[model samples]
Target chain A: MTEPKVKDNDVVVPGEELASGMGYLPGQGTYRDGDKIRANRLGLVHIDGRAIKLVPLAGRYLPKSGDVIIGKVRDVTYSGWIIDTNSAYRAMLSLKDATNAYIRKGADLTKFYSFGDYVVVKIFNVTSQNLIDLSMKGPGLRKLEQGRVITVDPSKVPRIIGKEGSMVSMIKTQTNCRITVGQNGVIWISGEPKNEIMAEGVIRKIEREAHVPGLTDKIKKELEKTNKGEQ
Target chain B: MTYSKRLDGRGFEDIREMEAKVGVVKNADGSAMFRMGKTIAYAAVYGPKDLYPKFLQDPERGILRVNYNMMPFSGMGDRVRPGPSRRSREIGMVSKNALLPVINLTDFKNAVVDVFIELPQTDAGTRCAGICAASLALADAGITMRDLVASVSIGKIGDKLVVDLTYDEEAIKDMDVADIPVAVIPSTGEISLLQMDGIISKEEITEAIEMAKRACVKINKVQVDALKKKFEVKKNE
Candidate 1:
């Protein structure tokens, strides 16, 4: 029988024994050491069925393909744009992938997307050489306007968005704010200044408490308290 | 041997009072502050971001750079000059090497991780405390590592071997015999950094290493506890 050495939410350090035996499979944040699995980082242990994974509490974002991210246009070349994806790798968005419109040679690309403009885009490809390709042709992909952006731990983005976007949608409806969560941990919230600050606070709370069980319910209660205070 | 006793009235194998806290710096990716008795050191880690200057970028693995600085008022003496001295540079290099073995740099190709350790107050064994703080800071920054590095200083005072020499003992004029500092990855029982000063017999050196290894196991537990406390979940409030 497969047995887990650590229970869910147990804080584990590097080289700590995670599980033993052939029935268990090592997952992210874990590596097999002989007949036992060991944690490769400081994180919380997560046992899911036969797989044991560790969820890191800290670290920089590692960019992957097909992830929706928010980045600032760092430079605009003749054919493409260099975007800062908040990771070690910078992303490139060609004019063709950025939009469907046909463009003539020598067209001014700066007019379309200039320096320092934050855009919501999706990663189209990531090469073994760490080269990243991004595209703006997707639903809700556009330049961010009049929204204050805050960054959290990128790994906590999933918790902030919740299952099927329920958590974010609840925040939007309660505060009546437009919220965009980039997989890279960049969040843009636009609404009344008061509501925007409230939304930002709630998002930060989620990021800090991502490892806690029943976090969704806690955030809901927090939103209710703020709603009552606002009325 | 009559004057070799520690000022604090502790046993030869006892370490100084050690305390570690992570996420001390708000702006840093990861930060930790460690205190050993009266000595205090703070470390902050930044990046895994792009390597700059172009010439130093490694294609296969990330480069690790460590800067160890001691404030002019950190010790009880005529003020030291602020900035990197020859001594600080040597300490920084050894500290960097101690951490390099554990950090998985290949995962972050063409990037750099910078660790800055500041000695706000120091007695003896400051480098060991700095290493301890740097490891916690790296872990807090979420850098993947094979294991955590822990270090301690073991020295021979007259004929007795002692762990974690204090400032007064380190400064003792002609009385102290040998100062050995060792950094190790406890899980693998590998020594990443070792330094020996003064005179020690071959047999004594082996014994001192064994003593340092035992001390390391205790220090490693402290490091792990600090990391766990940083990420511990708080009750709903």
Candidate 2:
């Protein structure tokens, strides 16, 4: 049987003892003491391998090509409705991409999108000048309903979702929170009090120590412990 | 002199308690921090990152961008904004010019190098101080360059040329005659950057240039001493 080694961030080299029963390779270094613990690539340790890599499952809000993000309408102009994509650059929902009907040259565009409404739209393109073009004519893309929104670092969205939706599915089963993780680092969590609290705690914990190893197991243990206590 | 002013028991031409330190920002590609009397500046260097978009890439030398920012508390009063304002833009240009001669940008093709200057306190002659700080930062970042650049500001007050000006002296003093600002590579005695703002005669400018050059040579020694101290401290650490 292979030994499970702990992975840590400070280890500059691979095969170093990260924690108890855990070792880290510099890059996607791996060992399978009992289970397959292999690294796929090298990056800053987001979470220690011994623990569950609890990626905060929130909808990614980063402006990317083909991502349908929910943005707040900030301004209305003759050409388009400016939407705040929660990025350094604002996304413009042009009248042309917004609807099939022609937006008059001098009509009140605010009627289409009020200041506070959350509109779901796909990013068609992002110019080098930081101009973002948004299109709303897509499936599962429209105005967002009432739900609290949260944000995380855009880089960590993939981890929150886990490989093939494993991590997020676990959270959904455990907490019953109807959560959505955006590519732009935004998360929408809506559910019962107990479920919302559990999800929020899990997400917050992930944000604080995503660089540590063995995050997945740690999160699982905590959640299981909480569940058992409730029973 | 019409207005007799004394600083630290020295005449008008004297410089204040000046010191330089290198390798201050460990994470930066290169870094140097300095305190000229009350003035303090930290400089960091990054890149030869590839110039974005092939069109912006230079065929010959790399593009150099110098950013100078004064911390809100860099002054005696309120804290400042992070981004560059008008004053910082002017200083940034001067700093870039100061380091130009020492850097052989042509060596790094299609690249862009950046220098960031953070001034925690502003006395006088920050431009020159920034130039000197940036050169050391560049060296620490391990960027290949011809030599270290040193800068000194020579301001005239009541017919005497001061090596480094203090805040009060710079503001109240009538610099009707232009002051000489020069950055030099002391090793080869090559001029990197030069500017004069007020209206001084050609003869006065020439004399001020000579005076500024001499001050920079002295300042360069301080830069070397600071680097040696840094290495000694690092060895112990």
TM-score of every candidate: 0.96, 0.49
List ranges where model 2 is wrong by over 4 Å: A1-231, B1-4, B78-82, B173-178, B234-237
The docking category that best describes candidate 1 is medium
Instruction: State residue A121's C-alpha deviation in candidate 2, in Å.
Output: 42
Highest lDDT: give the candidate number: 1
Give the alpha carbon lDDT tens digit for every residue of A63-103 in model 1. Answer: 88889999999999978999998988799999889988888
Over B2-90, each residue of candidate 2 has an lDDT whose tens digit, in order, gives: 44564545665556678888767755656789878888889988765556777987766678899998887777675677677898999
Candidate 1 has a TM-score of 0.96
Kindly list the per-residue Cα lDDT of model 1 for residues B1-237, writing each as its tens digit: 555567789889999988999899989999999888888999999988988898898887889999999999998886879977899999999999999988888878888999999999988888999999999899888899878899999998887889999888887786756789899888778999899889989999899999999999999888888888776635333
Model 2 error, position B30 (Å): 1.3
Q: What are the Cα lDDT values of the candidates?
A: 0.88, 0.66
* Chain A superposition TM-score per model: 0.94, 0.65
Best by DockQ: 1
